[model samples]
Target: MLISFGEHAKVVRLEILSKIGEGLQDRESGDRNTD
Candidate 1:
């Protein structure tokens, strides 16, 4: 299985975005717990 450079870049970008999103969600939930 071979992916072009552009396709690999896109996959990497999506993985990073998802990780950031998960971190944000965790922070938001923690804030709610303190209130």
Candidate 2:
């Protein structure tokens, strides 16, 4: 259970990082694609 939870947390963290990266690129560089 502990290993599973650790893996789940890693996944969640990765998702959050991906979202933040998208936001940063869009907001800071006007690099967002609407398509």
Candidate 3:
């Protein structure tokens, strides 16, 4: 099995987006706790 460069890039982008989403969710929850 093999992956192309474009396909690899797509996977990398998705991983990055998911990480960013998690960070945002964590920040929002932290703010709620502070209040």
Per-candidate total of colliding backbone pairs: 0, 0, 0
Using TM-score as the measure, name the better of candidate 1 and candidate 3. 3
Ranking by TM-score: 3, 1, 2
Q: Each prediction's Cα lDDT score?
A: 1.00, 0.83, 0.99
TM-score of each: 0.85, 0.69, 0.90
Q: What range of 10 consecutive residues in model 2 has the weakest lDDT sum? A: 26-35
Runs with alpha carbons beyond 4 Å of true place in candidate 2: 1-3, 31-35
Expressed as tens digits, the lDDT of each residue in 1-33 for candidate 2 is 356888999999999999999988778665444
Error of 2 at 9 (Å): 0.1
Q: Residue pairs in steric clash, candidate 2? A: none
Candidate 2 global lDDT: 0.83
Top candidate (lDDT): 1
